[model samples]
Target: MQWYLCALTALLLATGCKKTTCECPPKTDDPKMEYTELNDKAVGFNSSYSLDLNKDGEADFSFSTLLVGDPVLRRDYRQYYIVSKFYTNCLVNGNEETPVLQKGDKIGSLPPEGFHWYNASHVVIAQKIIEENGTSWSGNWKQVAHAYQPVSILKGDKTYYGWIELSFDMQSEKIILHRAAVAKDPNVEVKAGG
Candidate 1:
């Protein structure tokens, strides 16, 4: 009975996606590509966007917002971050923050000198910290708009690549997720937004 239920669930999920084949840039269409249409979804305080790169039930990564207050310090801190999940990594370096990438960038192995795959859990996109002295802003996504970031998923010894298109604004403290795509083929470099 358990085996029958598992097969049924898998069949439903396989047909749940409305679109499968990707018709991206000319000659870049990949039938094995999986795309998720978020359509400018805004994730802010108390809200988060869970991304399942391979249509699996588990979350590969997620974008979230957190706000904490310290009465003793008389300040509040609001932060935005992308949390890397199990076997998932973000493109980062010694700086610890993922760099804002341009669209169509190649995400492959042995990335540039200062760039490599790292499991950057709780990667700050932006942070608004208010102290008694004053309010200060920090992080690479403070003023970013329509930026691309690389995400890698490790399965066994193979790695799959993907990208997410998003925007973050300090004024609204919101992270807008436009879309995400993943290449089903392992070790294949996937172009951002393609």
Candidate 2:
């Protein structure tokens, strides 16, 4: 009886101490709304625009694309990078005049209250440039540069957290964004779809 009691206590303790793990469902798109695609016409040197990513007819974020020349080369040629800015008002229109970053402008400073920029080192997503007959395509979702990272967007009073991926095609001059809304509180249960 003594041995049986000891065995039962050990089994109970083992079972009680087992850790419970939560499995989150994979991200899926909402069939009702389509993903936004910005083509070459919409992007250019010093071009800026407000994007309605979730298709709610409201601009959730804004972006500025800049073309900078190589310092050492000092040629007329330039490379492109994007600066992303968040908006508190969903209906905020883009600034009339798009601002361009100069060669000496600071590129690594923390973004202002509502803005963030991506440079060579800290790209938000993997980028692929597909070319066909001298035309470029930058909206491929299959090619992910790096694993998804957590990002939070504050709209009004609530802050939404999620994973985001961005892709740009240099030749085609397009930007593709993929986002999945996660739980507001990371520790809480995450719903299946964003």
> Which candidate ranks first by TM-score, i.e. highest?
1
Quantify all predictions' global Cα lDDT against the true fold.
Answer: 0.83, 0.36
Give the TM-score (vs. native) of candidate 2.
Answer: 0.34
After superposition on all C-alphas, the RMSD of every candidate to the true structure, in Å, is 16.1, 12.7
Clashing pairs in 2: 126-145
Per-residue lDDT of model 1, residues 1-194, tens digit only: 99999999999988995677876766745536688888999998888889887887899999988888989889998888899976999877677778787887777786756867777477877889989788998888888899887888888999888889999877777999998888889988777777
lDDT of 2 by residue, 1-194 (tens): 99999999999999899888868876753222223334423334445555554456765455445443445644332223333344321111122111222222221123223444321222212133323333222222223332232233455655443333344445454444433333334222222122
Please list the residue runs of candidate 1 whose C-alpha ends up more than 4 Å from where it truly belongs after superposition.
1-32, 68-75
TM-score of 1: 0.77
